[model samples]
Target: MPLDLPSDSDTATLAETFRLLGDPTRLRILFFCLEAPRSVGDIAESLQLSQSLVSHHLRLLRGARLVRGNRLAKQIFYELSDKHVSGMLADMAHHVREDD
Candidate 1:
């Protein structure tokens, strides 16, 4: 049975967030950002993904407000949007590791 959710629209919104999280690439990207704020180039290099691909996903993540970027001189560094998101990811990681 479905647990009580605020409304259909709210469920849909939450589902959309999960949909974004469902992709392995996106998960990797998000987890990588947990380490520290990262540049697009740095994310690509570390994840071994194309810069274009990383940028594309970053655009989606930015749109969803899951990540925020800061301009440091000419480069933009991205980190989790806030401590709430960061803590959620950390707790989730711990849960997954414990489950294993």
Candidate 2:
């Protein structure tokens, strides 16, 4: 199937959001964020991934505006950028379970 491209700014935003969700690691990171804001260390520990690898995925997610990060003390905490991400994930979860 061919991928659709959004012509306008709004569609472009949607396209970017889809791109962010296309990666499994990014999806897992988003789920982790859904629970609470976490630092790269927290993500690494929870996901059992190396810090460098988690940081790499985080950089892409941040660039896509799917997630936001803030510095507190010495650690950078990340969370979902908007409510839509959580809504989309919830919808996806429902569809996946329906398929089973």
Candidate 3:
């Protein structure tokens, strides 16, 4: 089937989403989250990032609706917002791996 053209708002929003994804740190965060939901400290430790830096990027990702945080006890665990986000990350990984 032919792809449907996106509306102006959708195009703008997609541009914004791509813009956010363009950051290496954000991409690492998303890729890490894809494996499993993680707390801020876990992400910081795993990615070798400062807690405040991770928190800052997480805020932007949360605002963009690209990620969601769940509360367990006093910890906030974050992951991709939904399957679509997961698929997008997976597809991108596949594409990069293809070396095309």
lDDT of each: 0.87, 0.88, 0.93
Q: Candidate 2: which stretches are off by over 4 Å?
A: 1-12
Model 1, residue 82: C-alpha shift (Å):
4.4
Please report the candidate that would top lDDT against the real structure: 3
Comparing candidate 1 with candidate 2, which one achieves the higher TM-score? 1
RMSD (CA, Å), candidate 3 to true, equals 1.5
lDDT of 1: 0.87
Residues 1-100, model 2: lDDT tens digits = 7778657998888877888788888888888988899999999999998999999999988887778999999999999887877888878877988856
For each candidate, give its TM-score against the true structure.
0.88, 0.80, 0.90
Better of 1 and 3 by lDDT: 3
Alpha-carbon RMSD, each predicted model: 2.4, 4.2, 1.5
Candidates ranked by lDDT, best first?
3, 2, 1
Q: List the residue pairs that clash in candidate 3.
A: none
1-100, model 3: which lDDT tens digit per residue?
9999999999999898889899999999999998999999999999999999999999999999999999999999999996776898898899988865
